[model samples]
Target: MMKYLRYALLAVAFLLCVTVALANRAPVTLALWPDTVTAFLGFGYAVTLPLFAIVGGAVGLGLVFGLVWEWLREHAQRAEAAKMRRELEQMRRAHPETAARGATQPPRDKVLAILDEADGSS
Candidate 1:
């Protein structure tokens, strides 16, 4: 049911985008700089593209930049998580009794219990 809902939402979004593209079919000129600045510098550039293409390209670029920024911002948290995992693994290796105690304890969930049993058997 959730999967179907997600698909439905995606379809709606696609249709919306298609409608926007069709509605904004006019060509627009994009310039790197103003006409005066270009004349003074003698190195201005411009390109003609559909309005939808420009808007979509800007949105796509923004999404990519946001993703990259978020990933970079979380670098410290990711590093700390990795460090904790390594420390936990080292502690488990160093203390056989604690590891055995943990293994002997029954899991709270049926799925986890089944997984533990499978691990023990293997």
Candidate 2:
């Protein structure tokens, strides 16, 4: 599933680049830093196309990064939780005193029995 999603993202990026290249065929002059040169850049033909690509690529990369970061973080958290759970289980298994005390704690039956006796007296 992850492999397929990666392929889909790649295809989308390719299509976007192709679309930009196709739509922007003509060249126009660019006014770069400290120079108003007559240099013809392809992007100048359809300014919106490259702008869309740049913005979309940045956003797409950000999404992928965030997804990976979240997955890693969640994985780490689950691993830590699992370790703690295992440690607690081990302690419970090793300590007979703790288990005995926990088991010896009064059950609900005693409370119900006391209530029954009180009701009978009343």
Q: List model 1 lDDT by residue over 1-122, tens digit each.
A: 99999999999999999999999999999999999999999998999999999999999999999999999999999999999999999999899899999899876998888999999998
TM for candidate 2 is 0.30
Q: State residue 17's C-alpha deviation in candidate 2, in Å.
A: 21
Off by over 4 Å in 2: 1-57, 73-78, 96-122
lDDT of 2 by residue, 1-122 (tens): 99999999999999987797667655543333322232433322222334455555668999999999999879978999999999989998899799889889877698899999999999
Q: Candidate 1: where are CA atoms >4 Å away?
A: 107-122
Q: Per-residue lDDT for 46 in model 2?
A: 21
TM-score, one value per model = 0.85, 0.30
lDDT of 2 at 35: 28
